[model samples]
Target: LGLALDKPLVAVETLAALAYNLYDTEGLVCPIMDARRRQVYTGIYRFAGHRLETVSGQEAIGMDELLGKLEGLDGPVTFLGDGVPIFRRQIEETFCQPFSFAPPHLGRQRAGAVGALGMQYYKEGKIQTAAEHRPEYLRVSQAERERAERERRAQEGQG
Candidate 1:
């Protein structure tokens, strides 16, 4: 598989968004994956002149913050991904910009779409060996944090 990674935000929805953007659609392609704690992993993209242009890149941010960034953008934003339903109501209420959720067939993560994107990246010379591959855990797991806290408390004779 070929993919580039320079940031901790692993966009699970990128491939989905790319698939959805295959048509002659305009405005923003906002793909968001739930990150728990009211945050989501998201990115904004647009097909300007029929070429993909990243608006905000990928980010792990609260829904509110994400909305703030979209406040000034032009309308007709099409949002997709698993996180869409989680904040659907909030999205509807908060943004004055015209928006719509991608239908069931295109919104969720699909292996075919992801594989297609991987192939595209491979063609673009973004290949990397399995040895060079690494997982993108944007934040430490709660268990790890709790263990660290336990060790700290033990050292302080509080555990």
Candidate 2:
């Protein structure tokens, strides 16, 4: 709807879900979503001048691997997303640097955030056509995962 009206559409993957919630912070914004099997879908980002910059390629990685990347970083880091609660204690203990989780209100994605990012893109002359727009959804649903697990178990039993 916003695009039909001739507005710039900022790709959510460009800014990330957590980037929209972080306002005052100037440190790295690491958003991690649980991807199961001790792996997470994560992206590292930080604001450089007027724009948010990606510090690392987003990937589904194990906790130890993610910690290794974070170990190289200094200063404060804001950790958020559904993955945090799952591995909070491990993150606190394994991370040698100072870190904090976003507050409850700013922990998740919201519609207002998408709109705000869209406006910023408009001002920056980052407009896109409706035809060019495509949803950037990734990850399989829990139901699908469960079904796959059941199939795998049945196959194992047959063997």
Q: Any residue pairs clashing in model 1, and if so which?
A: none
Candidate 1, residues 1-159, lDDT tens digits: the string is: 333434222233453344344444688888878899999888887776644557877778899999888877885888887788899999998888888888856777666656655554556566655556666665678899999999998999953
Q: Residue 36 error for model 1, in Å?
A: 2.2
lDDT of 2 by residue, 50-115 (tens): 566678867778988988898898767888888889989999888887788987677678777667
In order, the Cα lDDT scores of the candidates are 0.71, 0.77
TM-score of 1: 0.74
Clashes of 2: 0
Candidate 1 — which residues are off by over 4 angstroms?
1-24, 48-53, 154-159
Instruction: Tell me the TM-score of model 2.
Output: 0.73
RMSD of 2: 4.5
Among these predicted structures, which one has the highest TM-score? 1
- Worst 10 contiguous positions by lDDT, candidate 2: 8-17
Q: What TM-score goes with each of the models? A: 0.74, 0.73
- Model 1 residue 127 lDDT score: 62
